[model samples]
Target: MGSNSHPAALYQLRIVTRILALVILLLVLVGFLLPTEYRVERSVSINAPLDVVSENMLSGQNLSQWMHVQGGRVESFDGVLQNDDSIRLLYDESDEIGELTLLEHTGNIIRFDVRPKLSTGLVHNRITLEDHASVTEVKWTIEGDLSVGLLSPYLAFFANDIAGQNFEVSLLNLKQQIESQN
Candidate 1:
């Protein structure tokens, strides 16, 4: 007679399958709840010194020149440095109208926090400068988190490549500006 080995064997299999499914469900749930942080960085060496390039880019006036609003702009002046020593900017790039705060500036490093029109979160800009005998090395980094809806984390997997490319372009522009001066 053909017979199953035992009911206990079938019960164990069912338990294992259920446990595996539950683990997968938990992983998916966790993924959806967590927001994704994205970072893009690019670096180039310029013919000038680090301090010189840092001065131009970190200053409010120079920041405005290189940092374009996604769309366009409003008439402006050199940004006023506040009591906290942070530079403030008011401009419209496309639909985004907001301020970019220059947070910190050392000899060769500058930090920025930006408030954009569409979303809520900090966009961090960091510039690092290295002094070389011939040319100065400049590293620019943009790191931020995009708050997600239920489906955003899933889509982020696809969006990261494009986001990285955009970061490259931003760094390229900064590099061009610094190099052009020489």
Candidate 2:
């Protein structure tokens, strides 16, 4: 009777602590097994010529007209929207923006490599225009790797829907801008 209560209480506390440790270990194992990268692609057909679409797409000055970018400013730019041109952009005065480099430029395809200032990952943005009779088929793709390790898979899971909506909206705006002018 002198020590019966103390032994029982100690045993109960050990059981609770072991259960919590096991739960945490399972969660960590799941996180490590999840994927960490994603690619988002969205496309739309525009009732405009390829040249018209290409010009508007390549011009940095027209970014605000069709894209919902917040506090975006072109810090520096070189060349004339052609291959090898590099543009430094700052958004919301945050160090999260990236540098856009034109990796490929052609009559029907344009590829850009984006290097973020605060992240170790790179983003590949590609725009392709195909002539379909009178309508131009525009395909926009953005692929990137998430560098946040265990938490990246959770982010990638929703990246497509969120980013896809933005892409669709921007494409609709671009289509309207080009068609209205023609």
Q: Against the true structure, what is each candidate's TM-score? A: 0.64, 0.77
TM-score leader: 2
**C-alpha lDDT score of every prediction, in listed order:** 0.66, 0.78
lDDT of 2 by residue, 1-182 (tens): 96999999999999999999999898778777777778999999999878878877767656546754435644533325778877775777676776778899899998987775536567788988999877899998999878686678778778899779878988898888888888
Collision pairs in model 2 = none
Q: In model 2, which range of ten residues has the least summed lDDT?
A: 70-79
Per-residue lDDT of candidate 1, residues 1-182 (tens digit) = 23566677889999999999999899789787766766666777778777677667655555556655544432245754432454333444354455666677778777777665435667787878889976788787877766656555655554457556655655566668877877
Q: State candidate 2's TM-score.
A: 0.77
Off by over 4 Å in 1: 1-35, 73-76, 79-96, 154-160
